[model samples]
Target chain A: MTKRVFKAAFVSSLPVLMGYSAMGMAAGILLAGTVKLKFLPFWAFLSSGINISGALQFIMVNWTEALLPLTQVALLTFCLNVRYAMYGFSLIEKFRPLPWLKRGYLIWSLTDETYALEVDSAARTPAGENQLDFCLGVAFLDHLYWLIGVTAGAVIGAALPFDSRGIDFAMTALFLVVLTDQCQSKINRLSAAVGIISAICGRVFFSTSNMLIPAMVMMGAVFIIFRGKFERKPEQKEGEE
Target chain B: MSRETYFLCMTLTAGVVTIALRAFPFLMFSGNRPVPPVIRYIGKVLPPAAIAMLIVYCYCSAYQDKSFASGGFGLPELAASVLVVALQFWKRNPLLSIISGTILYMVIVQNFV
Candidate 1:
């Protein structure tokens, strides 16, 4: 049964394997190149294993190289990961019966891809297989893939002979891919437009170092003020109402 | 602070904060309660906007570094991004799009400018 669960989980996570490893390598390489540090791969292992955040992984070099204030580091982490707070809402019931350790691991590894996979794993589970076990299997495999990718990239990054200039464009391409995928929906397009405008305004108003939080705040305000316009109609209630 | 200590502190802080955020809903709403409508609404809508903010942020960072100066004023970034979006639209394969776009960007910057 465990073997079946692992096989199913591995199959489901194959797509993520491709994405995480590629993107992780880019971030790791960027870190190795830009941050002048010994034992870089060790740090890569530690941070990636603990955090499991793609965007944060890419930007961490900036924080380290600048020796950013602890307060700023915490704030930026929150800003970068605040979206994570919502991922657990949908999974609360699914994970409710889990033991503390397993649940904690699932939450810790709840990256965007992992969350999507875990949520969808129920349908993929064999008829008699346990949901929690399947989810746990998926989570663990995804985590390992991410760790391997980042650590391997760090190792390769340290020894590469060629100039790695502009390799950071991988980060940009990642964001663009996500944005393009998200913009396929009409509602997301509206929200993305607001985000773009707000970010530009923040850029115009604040220095690059200070623009992110302001832009986030502006987005929140806009989202709230325009909530009535964009809220998806709760299904099954429109006709009765 | 020494460099090692500073990095250690940052790693700890970032790790803790990220864990806290990821665990927020589970800790707060573990009692079988329905998620608040406001929270639900934000959850559904925030991703695209946040991702959009991130893309702009990336562009701003690149601009700050003056990467455009070598590429005839940001031509490489502009062109590479167009290719990425176009390939994503056409092929719908993220791995191919990202790798090809990034490689294209590296070539443009390394050789052209």
Candidate 2:
């Protein structure tokens, strides 16, 4: 039974393995180039192991270089990751009966891909399967893949002597990929417009370093003010099952 | 604080904050209680907007460069983004899109500019 669960979870996570490892390598290489610290791969391992976030892994190199204020770090981390909170809402019932340790690990590893797979597996789980074990297996495998990717990138980056100019565009390309997917839905298109406008306004009004918080605030305000407009009608079943 | 200490602090801070955010909903509305309508509303709508915001943030960095004019007038970014969108739309394969786009940007910037 455990073998079957692992097989299902592993098959489901292959795509994430490809994505995370590739993206993680880029982020890891970025860190190696930007930060001159010795034992860089060790840091990469630790940070990637704990955070499990793509954007933050990329953004942290900048913060580390500047030694940005801890307050700013806290706030940016919050803003970047707040979406995970929303992801938990859909899984609350599925995860309700899990023991504290397993439940805690599940929440900790609830990345976008892992969450999607967990939810997918849950929906497809046949009667009498150990759903909890399947999810845990998926989370653990995804986490390991990410760790290996980042660590490998760091090791390779440290050893390479070639100029890696413009590799940072990988991060930009990632965001664009996510945005393109989001824009496929009509409602998301409007929300995206709100975000883009809010960000542009923030950029124009505030200094570059200070734009994010204001943009987030503005986006939130706009979303709330037009909730009726942006929020789908009750009959819509877009929420994850 | 020492550099190592500072780095550790930053890592722990980010980790703690992320865990808190991920766990907030579960802690708040466990058991049979219904989630607030407003919270559910935000959950449904916020992802697209936030992701859009991040995309803007990514490009804004390049725009912030002091050498924007010298940086091929942002042509590399624009071209690569177009490639990514077109390829992703056609293939719907994220790895193919991202890797191709990033490599194209790298090649363009490395050779042309």
Candidate 3:
């Protein structure tokens, strides 16, 4: 069991380790260089990212420029995490047994990439230790990469003196990369379409601050409306691997 | 409102709404009354739609205008998007296509275009 857990953890975490590191690197570069932010603030942002991951941090960096009040920050941070609230529903049955301390990172480390990985791996394994182990491994691995990338980006940002006009592209690139890698099925394609459409509509109709909620709600509505036809039934049993 | 106050309001609203979203769904479904057909249905495709909306959000603005329009027909962006689509469709490697296309666009835009 110990060996199995280790194996599951390592294999599941491999992608996260690779992806987050690159993304974190890009983020660090932007915050430190283009924005000319200090290391302490950058560090603060990176560590906090362990909880919410990618998008929020990017927004936070911009918000910091605006220098909003702490209450606003906490509120927005909490609200930005609403999707996780949604994701949490799908996971309650799976993690209800764990203590919040153990579940804290487990729930908190759910970046977009991490969630995709854990969800896919969990679907491949039975709803037990193997699944849990895989999920934990992915989180641990992804988090490790993010920390390293943050440090690296900070260091590099400190070193480089040029304008570094294109540093922000790193996040965009990472997103495109992770998204492309995951889009193997018709379901993924449709999901991408739905996400894009809903976000565009949401943004057009709503303020930037409020766009995410409506986007999530609309996506949720669409999914509920078409769950039966969204994807084919799972053809294989778990543990086939 | 001042920027700080506006952000503060946004922050508070986000926190309350998020906690409610997270906590409410589970409590409502705790008894397992068959997942209300409507909810279960929504669950099926919400992830995709949500992700798609985010991507579109990344490219376009709140006004629904093409962000790239200011720059005109960008070869790199074109290359990257096309590469992502074609590679994803043919080789079906979502990662490869995304990387190639995004990188192509980033590189193309950064230096040449």
Instruction: TM-score for candidate 1, please give it.
Output: 0.90
Docking class of 1: medium
Question: Per-residue lDDT for A1-241 in model 1, tens only?
Answer: 3898889999999998988898888889988887877688998898899888888888787777667688878876876677899889889889989889989999999998999988997798988999889999989999998998898889899988678877778878887888899899999999899888988999999977677788888888887777777787743222111
Give the lowest summed-lDDT range of ten residues in model 2 chain A. A232-241
lDDT of 1: 0.84
Q: Write candidate 2's Cα lDDT for A116-197 as tens digits.
A: 9888776645466788888988999999999889988998988997678777777777777887887899998998898889
Provide the TM-score of chain A alone for each candidate, in the order shown: 0.87, 0.88, 0.62
Candidate 3 residue lDDT tens string, A82-180? 455556666667766666765666765666667677667655454455667667777777767777776677678778786564344444444455456
**Whole-model lDDT values for every prediction:** 0.84, 0.83, 0.57
Question: Worst ten-residue run, lDDT, model 3 chain A?
Answer: A232-241
Rank all candidate structures by their TM-score, best first, as comma-separated numbers.
2, 1, 3
DockQ for the candidates, in order: 0.68, 0.68, 0.31
RMSD of 1: 3.8
Better of 1 and 3 by lDDT: 1
Any residue pairs clashing in model 2, and if so which?
A: none
**TM-score, cand. 2:** 0.90
Give candidate 3 regions above 4 Å deviation: A1-12, A33-36, A40-52, A55-96, A111-138, A173-241, B1-34, B61-70, B73-75, B88-99
